[model samples]
Target: MQKNALKNIIYSIVLLLLVFLVYLYRKDQPITSDNPDSDVFKMVVSGQTMGTSYRIVYLDPSGRDFKQQIDSLLEVFNQSLSTYIPDSEISRFNKGDSLVYESKFFFPILAKSKEVYTNTDGAFDPTVGPLVNVWGFGPGGASLEDSVSIPDLLRQVGLEKVEFDSVQVRKNTPGIYLDFSAIAKGYGVDVVGRFLESKEIEHFLVEIGGELMAKGSNENGELWRVGISKPDEEGAANELFGIIALNAKGLATSGNYRNFYIVDGKKYSHTISPFTGYPVVHGLLGATVVADDCMTADAYATAMMVMGTEKSIALQKEVEGLEIFLIFSDENGMIKSYVSEGLKPYLSYAEQNKPSLDQ
Candidate 1:
C-alpha cells in the first residue's frame, strides 16, 4: 500500500508541472482579435513633450502597455531637438557649438530641412530664427522693432548660411540660428510611429501638437479620421472646419489666425517671410498639407503659409504625392478654400461652415 501511494504522488507532481508549462505558453502567445477568447486590445498613451501634449493610439495583439517606453523615446528626441531645453543639441548649435555629430536625431532633421529649404526657394528656411525672435513669436518674446533693422536680420536668414552633412554640421555665419520648431513636432510624431512599427505593431496613430501620422486601420477596423480646426482667434471658440480620412499618411496644418498681433492697426502674423524679414501679411489664413511622412507635411504647410494661396497651389501641381487644402479670404472678405484633386475624395466639410470650394 505504501508503494502505491508513492507512485500516485509522483504522478500528481508531473501533472502540476505540465499544467504550469501550458499556462506559461498561453501567457506569451498573442491573440489577434477582440473576442472574449482573444487578447488583442487597443491601447492609448498620452503625455506632454516638446512643450505640447502627445497622444498615441495603437492596437496591440499582445495586450502590452508601452507608455513608459514611449515617454523615454520622446525624452531622448527632445534632448536632441528641443530649443526650449537650453542645453539640447539644437540649443547648443544655436549657442555657437556647430559640431553635433553625437546625436542620432539631429542629422535626419537637418537633412530634411535642407531639402525643404531648397525646394521652397528659401520659403521653408530654418535659419529664419532671428526674424522669428524679433517678431515676438520665438523664445525671445520682446519685439525688437525699435532697435533691430530688417535688412540686417535678413542677412542671417538663409539655409545657405549653414553647411551640414550626415556626420557634422557647421555654421558658415556666426549669427546664424537654426530653429526646427515648425518641423520638429511632426518629426516627433514620426519618431514615435517608427518605434511602434519596430515593435511589430501594424496599426497606430501618433500625434504631437497639431501634426499627426496614421497607419493601418483604427480600433473599429476603419480608416483613421482626423479633423482640422477652423482658423479663429486665440480666444474664440474652437471648432472643426473639416474632417479627413487618413490612410497611411501624415497631415499637418499651419495658420496665422490664432497667433498674431495687431500693432498700430496692422496685423502681424507669426509666420515671418525669410526673404522679406517680416511677418507675412496675406489673405491665406491656413494651409494644410498631407504627405507620406509627417515631417514633410509639417514643413510644406509652413512653406505654404509663407507662399500665399496662388504660389502654394502652383507648388502642389509641381510636386507629386503632395495634397494641399488652402483656406483664404476673397476680395469681399468671404472665406474660400482650394482643395487639391487628391484630397477631395477624402475630405468633407463641417455642418455649420462650408466655404466655397475651388479645385
Candidate 2:
C-alpha cells in the first residue's frame, strides 16, 4: 500500500475541517463564546504519526507547552502498537512472539477490539490481519484471486482464536495476528485527549488522519462545529455530507469510495469482510459514527460501512451512545442518504448559526 493509501483508507469516512474552525479562531470572529474569560489563546500543533498526520487545537489558558510530552507519548504509543515498526509489540506478535508483555496502550485497544468484534457479529475484527494480508492490503502485496475457495489464511483469522489475560495475549493458531490499525488511531486521539484534560485544558480538538474527538466549545463559546466531506466528489471543493456540532464527543467516519481498486471491472474496497474473506462489494458508500469515545466511534464507523446502511441503522437502534449518518447509492445508483434520529439534532442547525465555517 502507498504511504498515503492507509491514510486515505482510514480518512475516507470523515474529514475534520479544522481549517475552517482555525479560521474562526484566528480571526477572533464572534463565533461561539461559552467562555467568559478572554485570557485563553489557541495553540495549533501538527505532526506526523502512524503513517498519517495529526492536528491538535486547544485553548492554552496556561503558558505550559505540551509539544514534547505529546511527541513522547505518541512515540511510546507507536512502539506499542504500530505495525510498521518491526520491533513494535504488534509486529513482534505477528512475527510469532509467544510471551510478549503488553503495554498500557496496547491492552485497552485489544480489549476494545474484542468488544467491537462481538458487538458487530465479527464485522470489526483485529484477527483479520492474515485475511488483510492475503487481500494485498498488507505489507507484502499478495492477492488470492485464483481460488474461489476461502484461502487457508482465513482459517487462522478469528477473534475467538486469540486469548488474552491482564498479563499477555496468546494466539490459539500461531498464524492468528492482531491488527489494531482500524482502532488504534482513535485510541491515540483519546490518549492525547486524556493528556490535555490532565493538564486542565478543557476545550480542544484532536484528530489523527480523519478520526477525531472534540470537547467543550470553540473560542465562540458555542459547540465545536465539524463538517463531514461528501464522499463521491474529488477536488471540487468540499461538498459536505453535513455540518454538525461536536462537543465532548468523538466522531469517526469510514468509507470505501477512495480506498478501493478495480479488477476485471469489479471494484474491491479496502474493507475486507471477515466472514467471506473478500473485500466488501456493497452500495454503502460511507458511514460517520459518533460515540462517547473515539475508539468506539472508529470501530462502529468501519463496521457500519461493512454492515451497509440498513444494518447499521438497525444496529444503531439497539446500541446506545451512538449517532450515525450513512450515505449510500440506491438501486439506480442515485445518491441517497440516511441520518439516524440520534444524529439529526446535531446537523439541524442553520448555516449562519453553525459553530464553525461560513459555508
Candidate 3:
C-alpha cells in the first residue's frame, strides 16, 4: 500500500511538470520556424510591453539560442532608447540634472546629428524640442490650437544652443529642448540590427516604428522586399511606386500625409522645419531615402522635406551615394513623383500625372 501511494505521488508531480513544459512550448512555438528548409522566420514581438512592434525576420537557422539572444538585445535597446521611460538614458538626459554623461550609443547619435544640421542649414535640427513641446508633441505636452507665437517658437529652434562636450550635454537656452523625432527610430533599428549581427544573425530585417534595416539574403538567396507606403489614400501594394531589395541597408520615409492635424484648414506637416519653427506646408508630400544607415536615411528625409522638391532632387544628383524618391503635390492638388537615377532600377511610378522637369 505504501509503495502504491509513493508511485501515485511521483506520477502526479511528473504530470504537472509535463503540463508546464507544454504550456511554455505552446507560448513560444516559432511562428514560421518550421522553415528550417525555408529561408525566413517571421516573428512579431508585441509593442505593448515595448513602445512599438519590433518585427524581426531572420534567414539563418541559429534557432532557439538566436531567439534568446534577441530577447536580451531588446531589453538593452528599451533601456537605452525609450523616450517615455524616465530611467532611459534619453529620458534621464531630458530630466535635467548632473550631466548623464554619454553612453556608447547616445553620444554617437548626438554627434552625427550635427552633420544633418549642417546639411539642412538647421532645417533638421534635433534641438527643435522647444517648438515640438510648444506644439505639445513632447511628454510635457503641447497644443495644436494653442496660441503659438511664431517668434516664441523661433527662439528655440537652433542647434547652436545645445552644448555637448564629451562628458556632458547642456542646454544653453532655457526654453530649448532636444527631441530626436527625426532620427531616433532609425537609430533604434540600427541598434537592433547590430545586436542581431553580434549574435551571428547574418540575415535579418529589423523594423522599429516605420524605419527598417535589412541584412543579408534569406535562405532562398533573395534580398528582402520592402514596400514603401504611399501618401495617396487609394493606393495599394500594386500602387506602391517604390520597392527596394535590401541587403544590410536601412530605408526610411517622412511624409505629411500622416500624423498631422489641420487647424483653420491649413494643412501642416509634423516634420517641422527648424529654421522657420513651423510645420512645413511644402509642396513635397513625402520623401523616402535608402542608405547604408538608418540614421542617415532618417535625417536625410527630413532635410529633403525642408529643401522642397527642386533643391532636394538637385542635392541628390550631387551626392554620389544617396538613393531617394520624392513625391509632391502641385498647386492643382495632383500627385507628382521623382526618383534619383541610382534608384531607377528599383522604382516604379504609380501615378499617371508625374511632375514635370519644367516645373
Candidate 4:
C-alpha cells in the first residue's frame, strides 16, 4: 500500500509539470480571437512619429506584431520629409540646397502640392512657411511688428516658383520655403497602410494624429468608424459632432477653432491665407474631407478652411469622388453644417443636436 501511494505521487508531479509548461507556452503566444469562426488575430501597434502619435490596428492570420518595423519605416520617412529634423531632406532643401535628387519621398509630395495648388487656385500653398513664421505660428514667435513685411513674404509664397521632377527639386526663388505640415501626417498614415498591405494585411486602419486611412473591415467584421470633433475652444471638453464609417478610403479634418491667439480682444487664426498673407476670417469653423487618399483629403481640408463654405461646396461639386462635411456659422450666427450627398450616407449625428444641414 505504501509503494502504491509513492507511485501515485510521482505521477501527479509529472502531470502538474506538463500543465505548467503548457501554460507558459500559451502565455508567450499571440492573442487570438475566442470565436471559432474567425482564424485571424487582431494586433495593435502605436508609437510617436512626425510630432504626433500613430496607431495601427490590423487583422493578421499569422499574428505578427510589427511595431519595430513600423517604427523603422517612420524614421526613414522622417529623414526624407520632416522639416523639424535639422538635417532632413526637406530642411536641407528649405535651407537652399537646390538639388535633393536622392529623396524618393520629397518629389511625390511636391507634385501633389503643385496639383492641389493649381486646383485650389493657390489656396493650399506649402510656400506660406515664411508667413506662418512671422505670424507666430511657426518656429518664429509672434512679431506683430514684422507684419509690415507681409507683402514681401507674399512674393515668396507661391508653389509655381518651385520646380521639381521625379529626380530632383529646384527652387526658382531662394526665399521660397516648403512646409508640408498640412499634409505630412496624412501621408504618414498612407505610408503605414501601404506597409501593412505589403505584409499581406488585408484588414487594417492606420491613423496619424487625427487623419486616418481605413481598408477592409475591422476585427469584428464591420467598417471602421471615425469621429469628428465639435469645433470648440482648446480647453473645452472633448465632444464628437458626428461619426462616419469608412472603408478603403481616407478622412481628414482641419479646423481653426483650437489653434488661434487672441490679442486686444481680436482673434487670430493659425491658418494664414496664401493670398492675403494673413489669418483668414470666415464663418467656416471646421472642414472635414474624404478622398481616395489621405494626402489629398488633408490638403483639401486645409484649402476648404481658407475657401470658406460656398467656395468649398462649389469645389467639391467640381471634383469627382471628393466629399466634404463643413461646420460653419449661418447668417443668423447659428451653427450649421453642409454635408455632401456622397458623405451623408456614411455619417450619423445625435438627433437632439443634429446640425441644420445647409444643403
lDDT of 2 by residue, 92-187 (tens): 988884645757887788788888888899999888877776665665544545663566778878889988877788888877888887888889
Candidate 3 residues lying further than 4 Å off, grouped into runs, are 1-50, 65-72, 144-147, 233-239, 349-359
Model 4 regions more than 4 Å off: 1-37, 234-237, 355-358
Instruction: Give the TM-score (vs. native) of candidate 4.
Output: 0.88
What range of 10 consecutive residues in model 1 has the weakest lDDT sum?
Answer: 17-26
TM-score of each: 0.87, 0.87, 0.79, 0.88
Q: Clashes in model 3: which pairs?
A: 136-141, 136-142
Weakest lDDT window of 10 consecutive positions for candidate 2: 23-32
Give the per-residue lDDT digits (tens) of candidate 4, residues 1-359: 23323333333222111101001111223444548765776777877887666777878888899999999999999998887788888888888848646656788788888988999999999999998867766544566673367888899989989888888888898788889988888888888889999999998888787788899987566788876766666422236667778869998888777666666667778789999999999899889899989999999998998999999999999988789988898888877888999988898874644755555
Return the top candidate by TM-score.
4
RMSD of 3: 13.6
Error of 1 at 193 (Å): 0.2
Compared to the true structure, candidate 3 yields what TM-score?
0.79
Clash pairs, model 2 backbone: 13-253, 13-254, 32-220, 32-221, 33-220, 33-221, 34-221
Model 2 misplaced regions, further than 4 Å: 1-37, 142-149, 233-237, 348-359
lDDT against the true structure, per candidate, is 0.78, 0.75, 0.63, 0.78
Better of 3 and 4 by lDDT: 4
